[model samples]
Target: MLLHLPEGGRVVHEEHAPITLPKGWFRVIRQREYVPGSVRIVAD
Candidate 1:
């Protein structure tokens, strides 16, 4: 996964993965992360 922090907001890129869901059977994959609030923003 690739993450980009632009001047306005944040961007994220993720690769597909396999996952199981309740009630039904399915597969899915995703990438994600959390950014700290201490980071400075250009607008806010």
Candidate 2:
């Protein structure tokens, strides 16, 4: 099942760029400078 935050919001589709989700105006982490394969998920 897919989970959606804020229930509903606006979505902007762009051909030259990625689709932007305006819901809640949450900031997305675009990119980080680091060594390759350093990203990982940890359970709390």
Candidate 3:
């Protein structure tokens, strides 16, 4: 997904600490895992 932070912001996840970001465009990528037949986002 594409994210745009005009005035900057913070990202928080349950398994990770809050990440501070500068004002800019960013790409959000999910962690992927490979299964027997396909690849998918890693589950926590």
Candidate 4:
């Protein structure tokens, strides 16, 4: 997915520190985790 921070902004989450984004376009990628048998997207 793609995210656009037209005027810049901040992304916040309880388990992570806030991310400051510049005014531009960004590609969104899901965090991945490795398990015993497979790989999966990390839950946020």
Winner of 2 and 4 under TM-score: 4
Q: Over all chains combined, what TM-score does candidate 1 have?
A: 0.19
Ranking by TM-score: 4, 3, 2, 1
* TM-score of model 2 vs. true structure: 0.20
Q: lDDT of all the models against the reference?
A: 0.38, 0.48, 0.94, 0.94
Ten contiguous residues minimizing lDDT sum, candidate 2: 22-31
lDDT of 1: 0.38
Candidate 3 positional error at 19, Å: 0.6
> Which 10 consecutive residues of model 4 have the lowest summed lDDT?
13-22
Predicted candidate 3 versus true structure: per-residue lDDT over 1-44, tens digit per residue: 99999999998999899999999999988999999999999977
Candidate 1 off by > 4 Å: 1-26, 37-44
| Residue pairs with backbone atoms closer than 3 Å in model 4 (clashes) | none
CA RMSD (A), model 2? 9.4
Q: How many residue pairs clash per model?
A: 2, 0, 0, 0
Candidate 3 yields a Cα-based lDDT of 0.94
Could you give candidate 2's per-residue lDDT for residues 1-44 as a string of tens digits?
24355744554545454554544435544444555768544322
lDDT of 1 by residue, 1-44 (tens): 34333333422435545433334323333644456855443431
What are the models' TM-scores? 0.19, 0.20, 0.71, 0.71
After superposition on all C-alphas, the RMSD of every candidate to the true structure, in Å, is 14.9, 9.4, 1.6, 1.5
As for TM-score, the candidate ahead, 1 or 2, is 2
